[model samples]
Target: MPQFSRHSRRGRVMIAIGLSALLLGTSACTRLRTHQGYQVDKLLVDSVQPGIDNRASVEGTLGRPSFVSQFGEQDWYYVSRNMRALAFSNPKPVEQTVLRVRFDPAGNVAAVDRMGLEQVAHISPSGDKTPTLGRHRSLFDEIFGNIGAVGAAGMGGGSAGGPGGGPNGS
Candidate 1:
């Protein structure tokens, strides 16, 4: 009887330990709060006044921008954002800022604009549609329209053989 009691006590201890570990592990995954101080310096870049500051002066004051235009050297973009989320929840953008600075013909700051989330439009996402009406021919047109082997097979001459080929070999 004493041995059984000892064994039961050991089982209870193991169960308690397992439950504690499970609870701690689950609770440890709580959502983490984003640090407000975690800000990027690029947010201030687009705020730079054109004509008032040259490239060197702008760089000295605001540092390098996040990205520059590849097609033209006249535009610069300064972008920064903060993200945060709970353990299982989706990460949400805490903040986002974009700056656009344009240089003039003389390579001096010409215009500067700063936009936040409120300024951006939330339009429904659109998919690309290849213009087939009067533009170019596509595989879809060849398969479904009036081209390709399938269309050729479907085309009938009213009779078995006149000017059209065989039914299966068209």
Candidate 2:
């Protein structure tokens, strides 16, 4: 059996340690990134009194909202989240917050609300089988179903009277 020299064994150990350190360092470097959208400070939100603040004043104080209500123009939402990912994995949200401000018909701030990650909902599919309409065909049926369908309407190239010619020609 070939035996490793003392120096070679030390070098192998060093290389293994280096590779391990690299892997650990890369994993440790994975950091959570915060994506801020319409950053609404609690103090600033409190500063704006509901009845006193109008749309213009709210925009001037807190800037534009992250999203506006789809059904109406009165509700504005400020959303923020922190997401973390490792290597090729998809980023997952670690923290989230949403601030909703409602405006009255007169374009005045009517109410303010806040929602956290506690309000988040996770939905998963119930099963693997998807319900489909109509009867399912077998593999062979799918492959041969159209074999004779093409020439069913008298569109085949062969003549009626003979193999390759019409009756008058024969």
Candidate 1's TM-score reads: 0.52
Segments in model 2 whose C-alpha atoms lie over 4 Å from true places: 1-29, 138-144, 150-170
Question: Number of clashing residue pairs in every model?
Answer: 0, 0
lDDT of 2 by residue, 16-94 (tens): 9999999998887677565756655779888877999999998888888899999989998889887787756778888
C-alpha positional error of residue 148 in candidate 1 after TM-score superposition, expressed in Å: 15
Show the colliding residue pairs in model 1: none
Compare the candidates by TM-score and give the number of the best one.
Answer: 2
Per-model root-mean-square deviation over C-alphas: 8.2, 7.0
Q: Quantify all predictions' global Cα lDDT against the true fold.
A: 0.71, 0.82
